[model samples]
Target: MARVKRNPMRGGNKFKLGVFGANADGCLSITRHPDRWMADWDDVLAAAQMSDRAGLDFFLPLARWKGFGGETNARHISYETFTFAAALSGLTEQIALFATVHTLIVPPVYAAKALVTLDHASHGRAGLNMVCGWNQPEFDMFGLTKPDQVYDQGREWFEILRRTLAGDAAFDFKGEFFDLKGVEGAPGPVQQPHPVTLSAAFSPPGRDFAAGSCDCIFTTFTTYDDAKVTIADFQSRVDKAGRQAGIFAPVHVVCRPTEQEARDYYQDYAVTRTDDAAVDQHMAMKKNMSGSHDPAAYDLYRKRFAGGAGSYPLIGTPEQIAEEMIGLNNLGFGGLAMSFVNPKYELPWFLDRLLPLLEKAGLRI
Candidate 1:
């Protein structure tokens, strides 16, 4: 393997790491497997504690209102993101907690206050993972209008949030989606200006929006070369604007002592027991709601729920998984977040087995 050079940015680490989907049931995998752990508070807390103790960087929960229909009823159970973040903040000593916000649902005024609420609980460790709504049915659950141009509305929503958190004196603003008059922003958040912000956007326009709007861009990639190209493009945009943004990749790990053991489990769980019906439901939703003409292009999206909605897989032994992380570090990825079938048991297992290799490889401190 090539020597992985740690990122040299003043505040950047070798690579940032976090846990995704621990706060939702089943980790988005539609299966009735015995190993699946419900992402209840106990489950999420266990994972959060392990990640914090292991010095991982962040925890992101997917926002879900309803579950896709299947025998498993995947992701039907969910914790509200801000409340989940607030609870995790008090329970753990470190590790940033990001509340995933469906920007359209919450007004910027209240959203700003809720963010501050978590920031106080975490003493500045709170952040936002803003997502434009993707599932039409999910939005229908809230009676929200499924806009013809969702990302544009998302841009407007973010602008309102951006200005609201800036906390300038009374201001008035009107936009296509939002209108505010004499809005006095909230007073203080522990983080300077505000807490960190992230957005999961993979398409070209979405990538540009993430690069220009957030401190970090969260995305899922299928290949290293593709990710390298996309990351370069996104960072170039951010750099041209005289700002720097981190690109956090999501990966799904199904590792064991040996590669075959891991592959067998993934093969059995992801393929043989794959929920094709549920996967199709999700894929159709993505194409219809996001206005993407080519949802099928996402290989993993078609492949059963690999890790919390098609995050890249690191399915191998601990050594192989560590090597994968090292390769991502070398490729200039800012961070990685992932999910597991059973985080309560598997998270500690991963930390115990993989943290040493990561440290040895110089990917973690």
Candidate 2:
């Protein structure tokens, strides 16, 4: 049999680009905008088709079981990631599709099979974002407790998945978190050893886990200098683990014909019409349950959370947004997963306006 090619996410453009959070309502913005992303099946399909045609690098979905309580509840209405990826795999031809999986929520054997199914369904365009579970409320809903050795459990989880995809033969397994007999998966992923894996991690342990297990790391930062520091820190960890992992950043954008118009709209949706209650709920939960941000960010970046779930923001005209993207590329980000207030309306606009700038900057082709 011919060796399967690498997942599109593994390499390509100097700066890869992806559409993030399209599976959830309101994309990433906790806002009261009348036309905030509805996340209906049609809307999700439209966004995926648009992104695929635009030659976007990938389509990444968030794994959210419950909504941050508030007026809009932000991501309350959402599609399950694996199913979302599978559906899109049949519809889109080029863009890679990722399913963000919380290791604790799905068994490793199940995850391995599902990913393989997606890989076959997409003909090797599938990818995985492995998440060590966070969000206590969501955990509560599942009647599961956050294990003390959270990342340790995650490590074991990935090991099982790795072994499961190794071949068709069943094997007994023992571990701190898992014990199984005759464990195995058939029809391993189309991508050789396994499909590409990424993790969004911010804390040291999280970074270490990602560096050790993932092919890519997704991280957040407050400034260019902050991002620089994060890159250096993560690179050190990757080196220590004797692995090479690409670093990706997530950003929320507000682009318009003029910088002022962009800023005004950003203020209108993210501040004036923001879903204050949902942002509060999200902030408090994330601060207490997750190490997904800097400690100072909770208080210092409330508007940021409202704007794009605490991701870095790019608000300006197409040229300005493109420049900011180039700046991130300079800092060594392998790619960006981006969200917008209303992707149904804005994504096409962005493709039409900003893509040319990125191409001219040599970030994409």
Best lDDT goes to which candidate? Answer: 2
Instruction: Tell me the spans in candidate 2 whose CA falls farther than 4 Å from its real position.
Output: 1-6
- Per-residue lDDT of model 2, residues 171-283, tens digit only: 88899989988997889888889988998778888899999999999888988888899999999999999989999988998889999999999999999999999999999
Q: Which candidate is the best by TM-score?
A: 2
- Give the TM-score comparing model 2 with the true structure, all chains together: 0.97
Over 60-99, each residue of candidate 1 has an lDDT whose tens digit, in order, gives 8888888776666677888899999998887887788889
Error of 1 at 193 (Å): 1.2
**lDDT agreement with native, every candidate:** 0.75, 0.89
Q: 291, model 1: CA deviation in Å? A: 6.7
